[model samples]
Target: MSRQTFLEPFNAKAMSYAEVARTFVPSTKFTQLAGAWNSVLVGPRGGGKTTLFKMLSVEGQEAWTGAAAEPYKQTVAYTGVYVPSDIAWGTMLESLIEAGQDETVGILFSEAAFVTHVLLSVAIGIDRHVALNPVLRLEPGAETATDEPTQADLERVIATIARLWKVQPVSLSPASLVDALRERLLNIKRDTRLRAKLKLTDTPTQEYLGIDMLESASQALQAFDAAYRRPHHRWCLLLDEFEVAPMHLQKTVLAAMRASGAQKLLLKVALAPCGPDLLYDQQGSAPPSQNNDVQQVQLWYADKTEAIEFCQQVFLSRSSIYPALAGKMPSEVFGTSAYAVVDDSEDAAQIDLFTLTGRNKKQVTEQFQALAEKDPTFQEFLRRKQIDVSRELGMQPSDRHGNTLRKIAPLVAFRNAYKGKSVGKKRGVKPFNTAYSGWESIAAISEGNPRWLIGLITRIMSNNDQVQFPVPTPQQTAGVQWNCQRYAEMLQSVANEQFGSIKTSTPIYDVLSKIGDYFHNRLVTATFVEDPPMSFVVDERVSDDVEHALRIAVNHGAIVCYQIAADVGGFPTLRGLRFRLTYLLAPVFKLPMRKSKSVSLSTILEAKPETPTSQDDPTANPAGQLIQGDLWAN
Candidate 1:
């Protein structure tokens, strides 16, 4: 399918298994489930965790059921449950009630009897209502039943359950009532089975309410599972938005499920990266050690290949679903393409389409060429449009476009065209250009942190039509500049928010500035060491600043810390955690340091002398030369 047609309804719904699987094949961590695992998958939001989980669950279900497919399938018994942490408590309560009814058998007679009695009353009431008036619906009202008791009459029957159990009045809470019901149901079982185990009497009244409730609830769910007939045999509890659950409750729920040894029951949870911290903080608990059973996995940026492939699959799936523009190039309309060209060389030909674009190069040159052909005058138009837009926006006319300006060109064009038509001075202050500008900058900076990328894109797209171009008056010009500056300021703001105060007295700023300078100076050929402690190098001019910033950054844990090696030629050179900061900072600030070591500044400043002299003084080196005729020649 063509790219343009495919993305027509992109991201409108959940993606298909094939499409998502194309983006991210299940990793070892995803596939390696030998037994029950208390796994916490963590990643930046929108980094495809949901997609991954969905794919895994579906695949697991398929494997368990031995469902027919073109290829042979594996048979396994696994139930996948997704419980968003937010509603975990209610779900747990519900599951408990279900389990209790299912597992109520011979041992716990009183608990089981209570559950049986409640079921019997409900059944008898329901049957009576059905027999008396077949079409009548059981609608509960405040008044007592005058004619036939409705299914709504079941409430009274359920409420009367307290008397049979010799218990306190049941609370109005649904969960509480469910708990109470489960407890009453379990009384018989507890009296018979648990009586001997706990050395107690086999009487419903003698059973502890809490234990009965818990045990009955567990058994009911088990029983329900055994009786149910479905192809996907196991039951799954999906927990969505898990971050909402209080930390203690999250732990409690997890602990309960773990203790149950309820095979064929799976717990799937969704939580933001911040969820863990919130859980820990609310519970006033220490962070779990690495060896702890509750494993946390963060959803981070995909390798370049994965991201590009994801983009491709998204475009393809959309195109297939939508018929219009079915055969055309997708990237042409979107200003980006997932299509890549292959060279004849074996090694080059073997490269995966996704990684080639992500790692080796971002520009789809052939696609760009095709787009250029679509609009023969596009390049010229873009240049002229940029100049006109820049003038209208009150930016200085310059031969070069800064990365920020170039990146936000589309936004500026759209905003400028929009503002040109609006006629009211009272239309409120023109939307800041930086609103869109900042997003593009962040994309370049973050290297496609999917959450941040999606967030920025969503934010800009929502305001795409609304952003206006104000006439460049003196005040408006200043406003535009202010907005531009503020866009840059966001990096610092976000950093500060995440890491706390970035004091000038600290070395972080110095290192950042130096790193910035280094990139500005050496626009190409920058490298970083990946091992701990990480360190970087650029031109010597910025070295001191970079060192200081590194120190501060390390101290604050802004980055994985590293140190520079003193010796350049030592084995395992550049030992430390190092990454090229140039990739991040170059688009923001263009530094002015010279890259060539051979070009000395002194040579450029020196003038030719009228006469030459051989200066062979004992103090002077033989290589030194002096001007003879004039001592101070200009």
Candidate 2:
């Protein structure tokens, strides 16, 4: 397959079972997920939540390679059944509720349809495991692989589940039983759709109503265990797209997940970080507590080391398919680091002098002097460390082993290199001041999301099939900007529905665009602003409309937020929240891809908005005294 051919699987849901398993790359979180505990796999969209959930299934395990797969296969005590939620289908189920007589009956009908889909997946998963175990040897214990159940035993188990699920099979075989379950689901959908279409006011009902979803699932697993001769075999129910599931159903599933330990069932649900509904079913009722009842495994790539390593592994794995990229590392293709030192007289495109260390003595001495002379903040930083800016820089001083100055040299080089140069359009539109590139920058911009990383890498590699390793800085910058533009377009369209009702509704894109401009002014355009605001904290008294807008922005990945205050359920209360724009758009806004201290959101919104202008008193505020106290306050 070509490099482009391999890129399709980056959208993990679109790939087949075998394809996903074949191309799977395991990360540290995979080990955490493979355990028997009930875990909520939380991350932004395209952060590989679906991929990880799919890998837990039997097919994924069967096609998995390397030393990692063997240990996981040999010792795993549970069989994974992957149940992917379809939002469209869930929406249909929700519509069906309106056709019912009362709210209680409506929910009953909706839950029945949802569970029918779940049960069908469970049956299908068991069938695949049974048929493939003999050849794949994924089952625990060496003898268990060859100990295939007799046709009669399998048929009896199928019959028992069919009866428990209130479905009659056309035949006493696994495939036939699956067909019956599918038909059952189809019938319910057909009935609901018909009622909804005719606007039926009569009491609506489903044949499978009142069947406890958890009880049926538990009983079905027991029947399968008895038939397979493994009396205590565990089942890991890998539920993907938990946020798409109806609100009531999510609560029920979460409640069941909390109590699943004694039932020999392990539930691992994959969901987006933020959603409209709280996980709790009742307003005042306590929700399932994290750590004590459930394990919350976040895949946000907050740890730079882990995210960088995983990005490298994914690059290597995906690039192996193309002959030109076979032996290349990300550094070899995207450049060694995000920033490099060059001669003070040169531009970013002048790459012959580029060095990752940023310690070329002449360049460092010249760049340091230029920045210190123009901006007094840099000079003060130097004075505080008692470092002579005129001296030729070679290495970190013994006296300042862990000091930030030595580490910030490369950043200084970058800041000086593009001080006033227009590299590309600002935020992919207006004339921008600088470009973000390099292997480390790409990884940071991805924010540990595999989809974003893959998109950026593919954009870089797709245009040049025969492109050589160590791609030039200019080409990398172009590709990064292109990727940023793509995401910027999407961000513009988000939150349209949530803001549709308000006459003065602010499009999320406009809000972020305004904020991005503000950040650009503080970080790059201003003369001598120190410790610019890279993020912001919201006050608790935000209007409901604005809070809802913010929540929608968060769920859509335009804004990345972290909770500071927690309730009994360990969920954030959306109060005093700290957040930053999604770094994938860093190139668009001409901002650095680093997280820093926050300022107040209200201050930014209240301040007179202004486009960034680089011609201001270039060196007047040498001590950062001109910076607004409330605008950049920690």
Candidate 3:
């Protein structure tokens, strides 16, 4: 069958579960955001933040728990309102600016408009919850109860407004105050049209409007719930893209939500990992991360075990959706001879010879025949080498008979030809090679991101899916190279987008290029040393540009920067970062699949001034003692 027949039904490239809701496979990220808990969810763009938010919805959760539409098994009535931060913030800014006020007054007015919108959402949430209770709807006093409850709600909202601004003479008319508040907010927005635009700048000012929105939302939620009398009298308010709101808004909303003491109202917000820091209160003094106020969960894989199983489930989930993939292993559908090792399978041996030595089977066979014609002993060894006993484990001919080169023809040829510079145990250097391959390699290339892993597979499956559209044969080295390069570039594009907004000296493209170039030059001789490290240690002394670049790289997932204690020049006991390109990009650079030793900045280069330098200035030897490898200097 065509690969499309088996794979197309399972494509999850959108990385969303809006349509294929049934095919939504749950991960640890799902479990963390699934219930009534409030969180500052920190992860990359496609790290399933939006997906988790969707999965927390009544229908989305039911699809997971195998029940009727319910957000969770808890008694709370749930309402998931997806508020996209950038869009909402932009719209509010536009409306507020249209009416022309001072930039300061305009910003405060915009914030007020936004907070009002959020609180109204809470009222609407309870309204939706209340709509479900027929007994409460039909109650004799239910219609009459709305006026008193709404008036009380108006008093609290008005009080919050009164506290914020001293100017107020017009009657609020509590009977239709929500409508009045909406109109009042609209009027402020309309007033902005008479003025010029405004921009938020970094200047120390205390004109910040901090009347708590979450507390106001909570108050409304409680009042509406009581007035309508919901079955469980509980509600979950999901605030998505909460981090994009002003830092003050984020802090005040979360702080007030925690302080609201409204058990019936549950607030869950989705936030990016790197942003105007949300962990601290607005004053930056108290941290609400004390478990009582706000909880945190990062969406990332802790280890290969977690990454492998999660990716496997994702693959299986996609496959299960297709009728053609019902009983077949992913290898059968995806062309992964996962059980095939380059040194074990005959086909794999040929493929690996081409990959390792840049030789085709025909050239290897012709060379073998030419060698046999010249030497009888070599020919006899070749016969014995061809006798497969137990694949790679089986011994080849003894070294006595002119070193009968068999099994890996390419390896034997390399050893026989370059006898003096052989990369073997004889030179005290472990083999300069990596044995990792197949499905596990694919998993590692994902770098623990489910969206990336699924994307990699879906892209490969779509190979020739656009042109002739044929089922690709099992993993070929050249094919793997092409696919991995494409995937890495895809990741680079994502990194570009993530770091695009940073108006700073650290351009992401330059950062990635610098890191890639540094390691490419450094790792060439790493195999000659004993247990060489693959990672690079960048010191703070190199340049501020480098430090900022590294930070941006780590945040955007371009490279994994790990902090370590090391002797950094004069600061012998200083702590700094050690970095390696995420393993996903390993194939792109042809680096060892296994993690490597850390290369320190002290060796690579010292900061040489613009003036001429002496022989001791390290500029004379940029490679340093470790990289100078005189023994490998052919």
Candidate 4:
């Protein structure tokens, strides 16, 4: 498969089965799974339950192509079953019986069922071959082949199996016929001709018992039943993706398999996150009866350390299900690296990107220094750009921006003037802000959701050197203006996607637009001010809505949120937060706004009384005013 498609199954990363089992710290649930019994994997999206399920149900399936086969291969001796919801119940049952006809082919049952005294376990759809089907295959006029299997083909196979194992072909009574058929089917051994045709493996762990080709359907079931009950050998059954199966069928199948006291038959089931809930929901409020007895296994996320280790392992182990980029750097460019540096100072002289090196340092120090040293003109230019945007956006002397900046001047001063450098200097490193500083913007935009932060960083890095604007030969004013406009449009689009639609009813659009305008203005203003406003707050009345929207935007990775103390009643209340408007809206849809802060009645009603006048009089008879007389009042 091509590299892009190769990693599709493993795209879930830490949430996948192998990673979760390996990296998740051991818990009671993990220990329970280690013991025998059925299991229900549970977790929210991205929690890694599915990954764990795959690890247990399909051994060696995820191994790298052409790798050495597993030692002590856990050949599936029983029938393991996977019941996809899309497949009809009858179709699923049929496939299991047909596949199980090969006495030597260990049947993995996707669902459960019972026979008289003999519990015939079946693993419904355990096809290692199907799982390994190539994702891409050739087609005429196709640029590349795709490997998606046809569901219709699978259903046919299932139907074939059901017909073969069916008993009393002409009868309407299913229970007795099914019972008789189950006995014959379980005892039957593989047909020699069928075994030879498939080039069946001869390993003791993998027996390929052939099925009778010439025998009619009824005759075959009868022969299989007689042979299956001999008890010389055991039949194993595996159930997979149980959550997707019909609840009634699942309960019936599981109940039957458990009832059969046969020693040789073993049952294994694969469950999804909601497996338990689905099962209980199907059963209703009544407590499970004495007849119901099945063990359960639960899968969940590994501990933080385990999760980190799993992530590292996923990056390191290139030959497993998800191979890494050969010779690529193991450490993430945007991860919390020791190379970053932070400083709190107003002196521009203190910042230098090139000479700085230390663990857990902020990038601001080195970035501010580098910009101030190598391209001081560019640094000054950005500051002026920010100031201009702020003024143009109407964030003026008494606006929210002005108020927030006045309160957090010290922090802005520190951020603006500070200089620091990364540790463990390496050659060919990009400038600090350009390289690692965007993560701060990402974090600022995403608020703290690692997923959103990663996505934003990934997008930014992907397009970092795309030459988005025209290069200036003479640096004319028109060219600069044109480039700036293009840049602004791009920034606006990103902001709109990330935070604009968070609330349709509120003024989020106005807020974000103002913020973006303020950001552009600050870049320009920072050049001249002792410390320009790097952050601002919305009106306190809308703080909750703003905060909630900001959080959603951040989680989806639209922007970063930081707590800032403002002068509330003169005690430096920490009531405000700040973000980069552009990053918050970078990943969602973009709709243009006709205007920000449209004029309305509320704006015009300055100092108006809460209640309206009771009545209106044209005159009180004093000039044009009507006078109230004592007689008229009586």
Q: Give model 2's clash tally.
A: 3
TM-score of 1: 0.37
Model 3, C-alpha of 376: deviation from truth (Å): 29
User: Which 10-residue window in model 2 sums to the lowest lDDT?
Assistant: 341-350
Q: Look at candidate 1 and tell me the lDDT of residue 230.
A: 28
Query: What lDDT would each prediction earn against the true structure?
Result: 0.33, 0.66, 0.47, 0.31
Positional deviation of residue 505's Cα in model 1 after best superposition, in angstroms: 14
Model 2: per-residue Cα lDDT at residue 626? 26
| Candidate 2: tens digits of C-alpha lDDT, residues 1-634 | 2545645426788888787887677888887778777888776667788888888887677678788578766645678888888664455655765554456655766777788888888889877866765322244443433455766567778888888988888887677778988898778777767777786777654558778877898888888887777888888888897777767777787777667866767888886665535545465655666766677777665455577778888888777877777888877777655242211122233233243244455666687787776665566767877778776454433333223443455556545654553322123334332336677778777776788888887776666555666777666777778888978898777645531222226676776777787776666445443345567766654555565566666656677664421332222445566777877877787676554556666655654655443333332223222222322222
**Residue-level lDDT tens digits of model 3 in 141-201:** 4454443334444445544443343224255322233454455455655544433344333
For residues 1-634, write the lDDT of model 1, one tens digit per residue.
2323212222312555454444333333344322354445543334455654554453333333222321222322444432222232233233333444322222233223433433333223223323434433544564544454343443344344434434443562223444554565455443444443454323334444323422433343343333232223443343445444544444544554444334444444445432322223324644333244344444432233333344443334333443443553333322321111111111321222222334323232232233333332334545554533323221112323332232333322222322222121011334333322321232333333333333333332233233222211233223323433443454354332211212233334434554443332222111110011112322223333343344334322232211221211111121222333321332234321111111111111121221111111122112111211011122
lDDT tens digits by residue: candidate 4, 463-527? 32322222111222222223324434543343322212233233434444544433333333223
TM-score on alpha carbons, each prediction: 0.37, 0.83, 0.63, 0.33
Full ranking by TM-score: 2, 3, 1, 4
Between candidates 3 and 4, name the one with more favorable TM-score. Answer: 3
Candidate 1: C-alpha RMSD after superposition: 20.2
Q: Give candidate 2 misplaced runs (Cα > 4 Å).
A: 1-3, 6-9, 93-101, 133-148, 201-205, 279-285, 338-361, 372-388, 394-402, 410-435, 498-504, 525-530, 562-572, 611-634
Query: Roughly what TM-score does model 2 have, to 2 decimal places?
Result: 0.83
**What lDDT score goes with residue 537 in model 3?**
62
**Residue 282 of model 1: what lDDT?**
26
